[model samples]
Target: MTEDAWVPLALSSMIEVGTSAGAVVQGQEIVVWRDSSGVAHTWEDRCPHRGMKMSFGFVRGDHIACLYHGWEYDQAGQCRYIPAHPQLEVPKTICVKTWAVAEAAGMIWVALGAVPPPPAEAEVTALRSLYLDAPLAAVLAALPEGFGGTLAGQVPLVTLDTDLGTLRIGVQPIDARRTALHLTVAGPATPDTLLALATRSDAFRLSLETAGAAA
Candidate 1:
C-alpha cells in the first residue's frame, strides 16, 4: 500500500450515522464510523489506553466511547474524556492513530498518509457490495467485459455500458485471498437495473471463486 494510495474501505451505506464498522486494509484493522452530522471517520481499531478494539465501542453524538473503560474519543482521535478521571482533562497526546478518510462514488476510502484527490464526479447510485474468496489479481482477471475506468487510485475497475446506463465496479482487497466488490451505476438507475447488476456481480464472483478453487 502506497502512502498516498486510496483504498476502498467500505460502502458509505455500511456505516450509518452514530454507528461504526470494522474494516481491514492490507491486514490492518480500521474502525470506520459516521458522526451524527453524517461525517465519516477512520482510525486504528485500538484505543490508546488499553489497546481495546474501538469498533466494539458505542457512539455518542460526535464521540466514540470505548466499551472497556468508557474512554471517550472525539473525531480527531483525541481522548476527550476518561470516565475514571472525570475532573482530569485528557491529555492531547493520548490519541488514537487516524487515517485520511473520504466518501465518494458511494464508497468509503482510507489512506495511510495523505489522500489523493476525490474520484471524478459522477451521478452514481450504489448497488451493493460483494465479498469474494480470491486474490485481488484473480478478481481483476475475472471482471466481466465492459469495465475500464478507475476510481480514486484503485485500478482494474469495470465500466459496463448497459441499456440503462454505465455501471462502475470497484474491488477492495480484504487480505491476500479475500475481497469486497462494490458496485455503482453511473447515472440514474431503476431498482430493476440495480438488481440485475447485483445478480450479475454475484455470478461473476462465483465464477472467479470456482475457477480459483479448481486451480
Candidate 2:
C-alpha cells in the first residue's frame, strides 16, 4: 500500500466516542478509536511497552489505556501516564506508532504514512458493510457497474448510480482471500431506499461468494 493513499478502515459509526475497534488493512493490524471530542485516531495495534494489542484497551477522555498494564497513550500515540508510576513522567520513547486518520462521508480512512487528500465532498450516507470470502480482484470484477475508481492503485472504491440515488462502495482487502465491502449511499436515503440498497448489496455479495466457491 502506498503511504500517501488512504485506506478505508471502518465505518464512522463503528467507533463511538470513548470507544475503540480493531481493523485489518492489507494484513496490517490497526486500532481505530474516537476521543471524547469526537476526533478519530488510528495506530498500530501493538503497545510498545509489552506488545499488547491496544484494541483491547479502554478510552478515557482523549487517551487510550492499555488493558494489560494500565499504560495510557494520548491521541498522538505518546505514552503520557503509567499506573505503576503515577508521579513519573513517561519517556518520550514509550509511544505507539500512529497513523493519519480522517472521517468523511460517514467513513473512517487511515493512511500508513502521509495522509492523502480527502475524498471529494459529497452528500452520502453510510449504508452497510459486507464481508466476502473472495479475493479483492474477483470482487471488483463482479461489481455490476460504476465502481471503477482505485485508490493507491490497489484499493477499489466505486460510486454507483441508482434510481433512488448514488451510492459508493469502498473495497477493503482483509487478506489473500477475504474482503470487507463498505457501502455509502447518497442522501437523503429513505427507509425504503436504504432497505433496497442493502438488499441489492447482499445479493451482490452472495453472488461473489458463490462464484468464489465454485471456482
Candidate 3:
C-alpha cells in the first residue's frame, strides 16, 4: 500500500495472452490483462465515461473494449477509440487510471504509487495464489504454526506447511468476505499442484469465519 513493496495480486499464468481478469488490490477493483504481444497492464476497474466496471469488457489485442459503450482503452488507460465518434481523438481526460505493474514469480504485482520498490527475487518463483473470505487477522490466527513470520517481509506473514511445500500466504483483506491470498512456496511446486493445494485453505478460512461470527 505504501508503494514501496510489490504486492502479489494474482498468478501470472492466470492471465493468459489476450485474456482479462479482475482482482482487488489496495482495496480497489483492478483489471489486468496481457496484450497480443504479451505485455501486461493494470488499471482501475471503473471506466471514466459511465463508471461501469471495465473488467466486463473484452480484449482486442492491446486494448480492452468496454462492454457498455464499446469504448476502447489501451494499457495506459487512455481512451484510444470510440465507436460512436470514430473520428474524434479521445480527450486526455477520458482515460482509465493506471497503476505500476510487474510480472514476477508467476504472479501479477501491482504497485499503488509511482516508483514502487522492486519485487524481491524469491517472488519470481511463486507456486500459486488463492483467495479467502475472512479478515487477515482470522487467516493468520488459523495458520497451523510457523507458516509465515513477517508480513510483507515486515508486514507479518502467516506461513503454512502444505503437502506441496511451505505455503506462504499473503493476506490482503478487501472486505468482510473478500481477501486475496497470494501463495508462495519456499520449495518446488508445479502450477497444477499449487492450485490443488489452495483447496486446503478453505477449511482454515471457514473455521476462522465461523468463529469470528460467533464471537
The number of the candidate with the highest TM-score is 2
Report lDDT (Cα) of residue 45, candidate 2. 97
- lDDT by residue for model 3 (167-208), tens: 555555565556677767775767777566555555555666
- The collision pairs in model 2 are none
lDDT of 3 at 78: 90
Which has the higher lDDT value, candidate number 1 or candidate number 2?
Answer: 2
**Per-residue alpha-carbon lDDT of model 2 for 138-189, expressed as tens digits?**
8777765423233232354666666757767776788888888888876778
Query: What C-alpha lDDT do the candidate models reach, one value each?
Result: 0.79, 0.80, 0.70
Off by over 4 Å in 1: 145-158, 162-164
lDDT winner, 2 or 3: 2
lDDT by residue for model 1 (48-147), tens = 8888899999899999989899999998999999998999988889999999887777788888767687755556888888888888877766664423
| Ranking according to TM-score, highest score first | 2, 1, 3
> What TM-score does each of the candidates earn?
0.88, 0.89, 0.82
How many residue pairs clash (N, CA or C atoms closer than 3 angstroms) in each of the candidate models, in the order given?
A: 2, 0, 12
Looking at model 3, which ten-residue stretch has the lowest summed lDDT? 147-156
